[model samples]
Target chain A: MIGQGVLNMNTISDKVMFYRGALVPMAATFAYSILVMIYVIIRSSLTIYGSMPKGERSLILWLNGFSVAYSVMIFSLIMAMVSSLVGAVTALILKKVLLHFNPQFQWNKVLIISFTTALALLTIHYLLLRIFLNGYMTFDYPETFLFWWGFPAVIFLGVVVVGSYQFNKALLGQHLKGNSTSN
Target chain B: MKHIKRFVSYTLFFYATTALIYWIFIRPLHLSWGATFKEINKAMPADSLISPNRVVTTRAINIQAPRERAWPWIAQTGQNKGGFNSYHWLENLFGASMVNADSIVRQWQHPVPGDTIYYGKHQGYQTISLVKPNECYSLGGWSFYLHAIDSGNTRLIIRYPSMEVGQSRWTSIYYYGLFEPLHFIMESGMMMGIKHKAERQK
Candidate 1:
């Protein structure tokens, strides 16, 4: 009966593993994007109002401003979705790579692998930004690139990796307790 | 259904965590550039641009050159004058026919208050509001200051103030969201250009 129970728990864990690996990172990326969007809007708004001259305070001006903000928000939302998908794929790839090395999951190994994956993703992102938004992401604003893109990518990867690990551990722990109780 | 709920909960957690990290670590760093708490809060001559309820941005850089060496670069910044030592291509894209000077031009070095400094052909001009040779100057709403930290180093400070012309929240959002980031990139490049010029001259 104990052997049967262990097998049952393993099956359940196997079923949930894919979901945990993919969804957790996706959700984290989406959330981070939303937070950044809000921040950018607020900061940008204060800057605009401060700079506008007294003569330019017309209804048409305000409308134009709102239209621009609305357009940017739309663009950001699309990018956020793309980033979420990328993050999910990265998490899944990391899990597969780690499993190839060791069947048993190790927190230290997970951290190391995830960090490397994050760095690789950051390089890809930087290249993409350079190719597309060359004007905005030029070498002149090295600090901006580091702060705006690099820092956030690191934090996102760290949070998703650790969060998913803790969550899976908790789920396994609960299943074990349930089996013991039933016995 | 359960999976969807879990995903939503985890997303909220990540959002809160990321937001907290940015607020605590990143926002403060971006808001003020190389300025101490006292220096950022201190009233500047540019404060007169928008006396009350004004928004001010302060950015500073440490130049290896003396105040005098950096002063010439600042003095000749305008559309027709020695163009703001920033990216000429980028400035040109914004309708500016800028040719950044590699060395100091003796003719453009002497700028007095009330003199007009054009930004671009059709964009606008900033009238020189204040001038203190090798020390400080204010043009329209922006003020530039040079402090001699020692014989070899100078702290270049710039203060930009804009009046809050009672607009709806939407106006502020638009300005910051679309225009401000672009402006920051150009301005930051300009600052680096000045530093590069000053250091090379030294």
Candidate 2:
């Protein structure tokens, strides 16, 4: 009975740790996704305004602003689902690769490393965006600073995603080689 | 390699299809809802213009003061008095700064017809179009567009077509629907501010 109780406690602790590791990325993605949606909305509105006559521009501008807000809400819901699915699939694949490469390679350490790295990259991307946007939004016409501000974030995310994929593959390969020789 | 290629293709297909659907269906659906600018404009009278898109608000005041009396206050428009001047909320968002009230108020004590007022990185050249001494005044000025466009130079023209009379239904409706507390702040609140100042002088 005591052993069963201990096992239950272990499961609970693992869940708690998993949740803790996941929380920051979830929040970051949600916030960044909203920002991206807002940017898209504003950009769309500006386009509408640009196309309209001078007298009618403001009407379209306001319309675009409200539309963007609505889009952001929808995006947040979709982003949450995508993030969880992607995160879980990634973690599972990494675990499998580690097991195949070296039977004794630590899984927990790799997860912690990946989670922390992703979190750091997200933070840096947001900071760089804030710097480039200056003080105005895309809704403010002729204020194209926001585009420059946010473009770097996309580049950074691309780099991180590709680099992590390569690094994970290399780590799994080394682990597999080390374990096969030992056995 | 085949699996990797498949994954890439699938991701690209999903994203492209989703984007295409959004552009074709969702965008048009939103535009059709009268929630769009074109639709809203069709709803409005031909002469009316709504500045901010989503919200509606506006205000106006009638004063028994001539154009000369009102010109000073209009030229030095600020937040406390209901002008975009000193609207700190807008400073960060739109790069607008309200003129110094002290200088504006002092300089505006008795503005005649043609006076130039200065604010940060911008200028206001005031002109009195019509004036009935101590009765009514129309105040207008050359104000550059808030956007950084070099389209000659834009202007803000406020016409006070009444002395203690309400605005036309058309003006009221557009202002109420589009401008909001800002329209109220500028037309009514600022007008009241001008009236108080001008009346005090009288």
Candidate 3:
């Protein structure tokens, strides 16, 4: 028992700490998905609106936006789900391996693990993009695509590191408070 | 022995990463950067001059501008003109003197057939063999074609119908190892640059 009870006891906070390793990236995906949704609707609708007669442009834009939204919503949702799921799975695996070494969480290790995992996942994501949703990326070259998306991934990597670090810190705090780390 | 082992490890790591990066990213793009099947196979005006024989490389982009709007950017592509509309920094790093224009200049809006297009001292030059205003601009073995998808959008295709043909084995290695990748990077940059300029105010 590292805390109030056995970490093996499967308590609510323990589960939250275990699974919610994915929470930050999940939140990021939700946020980025909405931005992508709005951007697509605006950009696609505007291009279509240009083909319309002046009198019907406003109506055309509105209708086109709706249709485009109907089409892209599924893609946007799927991307978010994929990102969150990947992040969650990565965190779960890493945390399990780390926790196996000891019941207490180490802050420095958590940060390093989270950041490296984000980079690896993003690289794989870029490659998998060629096989799926390549059109959605729109950039003619992968370098250009990476240049645009890499900054955001780096930003999220920071968030993930901080989030993972905090969660591990809390677990460590609990362990320290309990005055015992023996499993 | 420890020092020798460390040196060997570093060398192996370097080579491993270079090979990994080449296979994963560089090789695929150099093969056919962003070309669609239809775009790659579609016979172009350049085909008459170059002929797609051994190794064909076709790349294209969807420009969110009318064919008319995007044509001027393509028209102005030459060293003495508006430049190749590519990565000026990279090009200049190789003594290309590339200065990609941001706006369509009136004088450069048209190119007469038989004009020479410079790819700088590094990549040699091409001769303009055909010009069809907002339709096709052919420079001997290379060309750019615009297909209007709608009033507001165009499919800009860059076709080098014959990238290479039956050459010596050593030349083939040079083309694959060096020339193809460098060309892909510059060409892709040019496509994006054209798209960026054409899409402006469009």
lDDT, candidates in the order shown: 0.62, 0.39, 0.63
Model 1, runs deviating above 4 Å: A1-183, B1-27, B163-166
lDDT, candidate 1, B80-107, per-residue tens: 8999886565456444667788889999
Estimate, for each residue in B64-137, the C-alpha lDDT of model 3 and write its tens digit.
78988888988988977899876565455445556777778998886989887888644578778899999999
Two-chain complex of model 1, DockQ on C-alpha atoms against the true structure: 0.04
Give the alpha carbon lDDT tens digit for every residue of A1-183 in model 3: 332333342322445644564454545554554454476556545544443335634643443344333333333444546665666676665566456543445556666676776677678767887678554444544434443475457756776677667656666666565565553
Please identify model 3 stretches exceeding 4 Å from their true place.
A1-183, B1-12, B24-26, B121-123
Task: Encode model 1's per-residue lDDT on A1-183: one tens digit a residue.
Answer: 221222233433433555555555555555555555555445444443443334532422333233333434444444556655665566566555555543344556656666676677678877887798765443334444444575567766676567546644554465567778887
- Give me the displacement of residue B174 in model 2, in angstroms: 17
lDDT-wise, the better of 2 and 3 is 3
Q: Judged by lDDT, which candidate is best? A: 3
lDDT of 2 by residue, B109-133 (tens): 4434543333222323345433333
**DockQ per candidate:** 0.04, 0.04, 0.01
